[model samples]
Target: MHAGTTVELLCRLETEPTPDGGRAVVVVEVSDHHPARAVRARQASSADETRGHGLQLVGAVAESWGITYRRDLKTVWFRLLAGPHDRVYGPPARFSQDDPDLQRDLRAAELLAPAPVRRSPARRSDADWINHGALSFLAEASDLLSGQLDEEQVALLAAQLVVPRLADWCAVWLYDGGSRDSSGAPPRLARVWHSSEGRIDALRMALEKDPPVLPVPGPQRDGAGAAVPWPWPQEPSGYGPGGAALACRLLAGGRDQGALLIGRAGLMRFPDEVVGLIEDLTRRVARAVATARAYRNQERISQVLQRRLLPRGPATVPGLESSVVYEPREGAWAGGDFWDLFDAGDGRWCFALGDVCGSGPEAAAVTGLARPVLRLLARDGYGVGEVLDRLNKTMAREATDSVAAVAAAVAAAGPGPDAAVELRAEAEQTRFLSLLYGEIVPHADGTAGARCTLASAGHPLPLVLGAGGGVRVAAAPQMLLGVVEDTSYESESFDLAPGETLLCVTDGVTERRCGHRLFDDDDGLAGHLTACTGLGATAVAEHIRRAVHAFAATPPDDDLALLVLQATERR
Candidate 1:
C-alpha cells in the first residue's frame, strides 16, 4: 500500500455443490491481507489474478493499505491521505453531532486559532490579550465619563467594540432639538440612536410615525417617536444573535439632560462584567454634560452682568462725537474691562475705562466694585487724576493681591454755538488728568485742537490718527495710574485740522501679538489706524477692534477698551 493510503481487505474459502454448477461455503475460515489494494474488482479467477494495473495505481496513491481475516468472509477498505492541495475528509472520531457543547468548544477553538503572520506582533501572553482589551474598553469608557469624548468619539468606540466583536453593524443617533417640522415648527421625532445607518435614516424618514424615541423633555418625542427611558434598547429592532443594547439617561443637577445608547449584534447578551463597565462610563459622560451646562450658565450670567455694568450708549457732547467699545476676553473667564459714560451735567461728560489684571468671578467682582466707586468719584467732582489716585488706593486697600490699570478722561462742555472754541480753551487747562489722558476741543474759529496728557505708570502709549491720513505717536506719556500718589503728569496740545481724527485706547487695543512681534510696541496698530482714516468714530473703533483680533490670531489676552473721537468738517 502507498504511504498515505489506508486499506482493508477480506477473503473467503468455499466448497462447491454440483446442483447448478454453483459453489457453496462449508465451515470455511477466511483470512485477509494486502500490501496493495485494487481500486476496482472485475471478473477474474482469483484475487491474485485481479491485482493488475488497478492495484498498482492504488498502491502508488494510497499512504498505507491493510487487511484482516474473518471467520466466513473477508472485507477490504482503503483511505487516501490528503496532499498539499487536497482537502482532508470526514469528521474525527471524537466529534458528536448531537452535542452542542462540543460544537461550541470547537467553534471557539477555530475562532481563536493563530492567524497568518502579518504586520501585527504576536501576543506576548494570554494575560496581555485580556489586559489590552480591558484597558482599551476602560480608556474609552473613561473618556466618555469625563466628558472628554464627543459624539463622534462615542460612535467610534461603539463601532470598534461591538461591530466585529459581536459580528454585527451598529450606529448611534441623537435627538436634534433644533429640527423643525413641515409646519416650520419643532417636530416630535427627534430623539433616537441606532447601530445601523440605514435604520437611522428610515426612522428619520418616518418621523411622523410616532416611534419609540422621545425628546429629552417637554411633550415632544424624538425623531424615532420613542419615549426617553433608562436602559433603552441599543438595537432599534430587538432580534439577532450576540445582540444586546443598553441605554442610559444623561442627567445634570437632577434633570434629564440627554441619553447614551450602546449596542452589539448576535446572541451574546451583555455579561455583568461588560455591563458594569458601560454603566460606569455612562455616569462619567453624564457628569461631564452636567459640568458643561453649568459652565455655559455661568458664562451667560457673566456676559449679562458685564453688559449691565458697562455703557450701552455713546456719549453725546455738543462739540464732540465720541464712541467707546469694550470687548471681554474669550473662554470661560469673565473679564474686567469696564467703561462708563456718565452725564456730568451742564454740558459735561465723565468717561472712564479700566481693566483689572485678572479673570473669572474675582475679576468681575473688582469690576463691579470699581464701576460704582468711579461714578461716585465723578459725582464728587474728583478730577481724572484724583479719581485714579482714589481708585488705586481703593483697589490696593481692598484687594492687595490684585493688580489693575485705568485710562480716564473728564471734559466740561462749554455753552453756546461756539462751545467747541470754549471747550478747546478748557482742554488746554487740563493739567491734572495725567499724561495718558487726551482732550479734544474746538477753537473760537471752529478749528479743532487736541491735548495728549500721558502717564507711563508702565502703561502703553496712545496712537493718533490724523485727518490727512497722517499716523504718528501721541504726546510723550508719563507713569501709569495707581503707582504713586504724588506723581506729576504732563500734557501737550496740538492743532487738529478740518478732518483730523484722534484715537484714545487702552493697551489692550495695541498690545496684540503678531507672530513674534508685539503690536503695542510696534507700528502695526498705527498703520491700521492710518489705513482706516476718514471713518466715523464708531466705524474707526470697530475697524481697530477687528484688526487687533486678526493681528493676535485669536482673542486678546487682556480686556480691550477703545475710545474713538472724530472731528467732522462741520459740513
Candidate 2:
C-alpha cells in the first residue's frame, strides 16, 4: 500500500488487533530501522500467514519495526511518524546515527529560516532629507521680512521649500478684504502663481455653485488636483495636483491669516516631518504680516493725534498780528506747549502762552485741560491776575502734580483816548499772573500808547522789538504762577509806536541747542532774530520756528510756544 493509504488503515485499526488465535493486540514504538527490517520481521512471525496483510499495512505506516521476546510471550511493534494532529505522541527516542537523509533534511530546514526585520530604505532616506531641509528652510525664512516677501515671493518659497522637498505641488490662498462674490461675501481665492490655470478655473466654478462646498479632511484629489484644508475656514480654496496632500492654517495672534497647501504626486506623501516644516514656515509668515500691520496702525494713529493737538491758523487781532509755533519733545513723551487767543469781551482780546513741565500723554492731557480752562476764564472777563489765581486754584484742588508757567496779556482796542490811563490803573491792581499783562490804547490825537504790567513766576521774560529794529528784554521778572495766591504783580508803561513788534515765547526757544551748543545763551538765536527783524510778526515767528528746529536737529526736548504780535497803525 502507498504510505498515505497505509497511514489511513493504521489510523482505523489504532485500537484493534491482528486476526490471530491470540489476544487482539497493537504495539506502538519509535526507532530508526529501515523498511527491510519490517519485511524480515513479518517472515519470522509464527502468525505471519494469518496477519500478513495487517503486517504489510503496519510496515508501510511505521517509521521502524521490531519484536521483543519474553520468558512466556513475544511482542511485535511498529513505529509511526507523528502527523500534524498527533500531539499525544512525543518525538522519536532514537534514530540511526548513520542515516544521511535524515540529517540532510534537518539541516535544510535550519538553512531556510526567516531574516530579522529592519527599516525600509525609502523611510530612512526621506527622514534624513526632511531634517536637513527643515533646518535650512527655517534659517532662510527667518530672515525674510513682510516688506521683503510679497505675495508672489511667499508662493514661490512655498513651492520650492515644500513641493519639491515633499515631492508634491504646492499652493497658497489668501482671503480678500474687499470685493465680495455673488453671495455678498468677500472674495477669497488661491493666490496667483501658486495655482495652475485649470485648477484656478475649477475653483472659480466651485465658488459659483450654490452653498459652496467646504474643505473636508482626507485626500481630496480629483486626478492630479487636490484641495487641502486650510485653518482659515473663510478663506477660499487652494488647489494643487497630486495623490496625497496636506493643508496647514496660517495664524497670527489667534487670527486666521491664510492657508498653505502641499501636494504629493506619489505614494510617498507628506509624513509628520513634512507637515511640521510647513507649519513652522506658515507661522513665521503670519508673524511677519502681523508685525507690519501693527506698525502701520500705530503710525497712522500718532499722526492724527499730533495734527489734532497742534495749532492750525494764526491768531488775528485788530492792532496785533500774532503768529505761534509749537514743537514737541522727542522720546516717548508728547510735548505740552499750548497757546491761544480768546475774545475777553468789551472790545478786548486775551492771549496766553504756557508750557506744562513734563512730556508724554500725561503732560498732553494736562495741556488739553489747560487750553479750554484759560479760554473760559478769559471769556468770563477775568483780568490777567484773576485768571492765574483761578488756574492755580483748579490745579491745587485737582491735586495735579503737573506744574506750568503761563504769561497772559489783555488789551482793550476800542476805548477812548484816556484808555492808556484806565489800563495803567487796572494793571496796578492785577497781581496774580506770573505774567506780563499789556494793554494798547489810544492817546491824545488817537496815537496809541502801550502799558505793560508784568509779573513772573520762574518763567522767561518777554522780548520787545521796536519799530526801527531796537531790541530790549523785559527789565523786570517775577515769580511763577500757582506758587502764591496773594502775590502782587507790578505795572510798567511803554510807548507803542506804529509797526512795533512784541515777542513772547516759552523756555523751549531759549533752552534749545545746536548740536551741543546753546542757541540763546551764546547769542546765536538773538543774532538770528535781530538779522531777521525786517520780517512781520508772522514771518518772524516762522523764522524762529525754523531756527529752533534746525538748532535741536530733532524734535524739541520740551514744548516750545512762540507768540509774535506786531502793531499795525491806520495809515
Error of 2 at 430 (Å): 29
Q: Rate the local accuracy (lDDT) of all candidates.
A: 0.48, 0.50
Candidate 1 residue lDDT tens string, 1-571: 2223444433343444458764433221223343223334335344233222332233233332222223322333333432333455776567567877765433322332333241124213324433445555455445433442243343343333433322234333332321122123323332333333224444344333432343454433222222122332433443233355555444333444444455554434555555555455545554554454444445555666566566658666545567787776665456666666666543345655555555554456566667787778767765555666676566545542221211000101101112222223222222112113433344555544432233223345566677778887655655544445565444455665555666766667766766778875647778888888778777888888888887766667777777776665553
- Residue 316 C-alpha lDDT in model 1: 65
Quality of model 1 by C-alpha lDDT: 0.48
TM-score for each model:
0.51, 0.50
Q: Stretches of candidate 1 above 4 Å error?
A: 1-132, 140-191, 197-269, 323-333, 399-458, 465-498, 522-560, 569-571
- Those runs of model 2 whose alpha carbons end farther than 4 Å from true positions after fitting are 1-312, 327-335, 396-446, 449-460, 475-496, 506-508, 552-561
**Per-residue lDDT of candidate 2, residues 1-571 (tens digit):** 2121221122222433336622323446322222112232223334213332433344334433433322322234554433434456766667697877666533321332221121122133556766645575576556533433244444444444443345434555554431111124422444422222224444444433422233323333311122244222122443433356566654554444455555554443556676666667777765554454444333343354355555566445556667777666554434556666645565656666666555443345455566667678767876665666666665444314322211111111111112232223322222222333443333436455333433344556677777677777753676555456565545445655566777777788888866767768856555666766668887998888888888855677666778777776644
Report the Cα RMSD per candidate: 26.6, 34.6
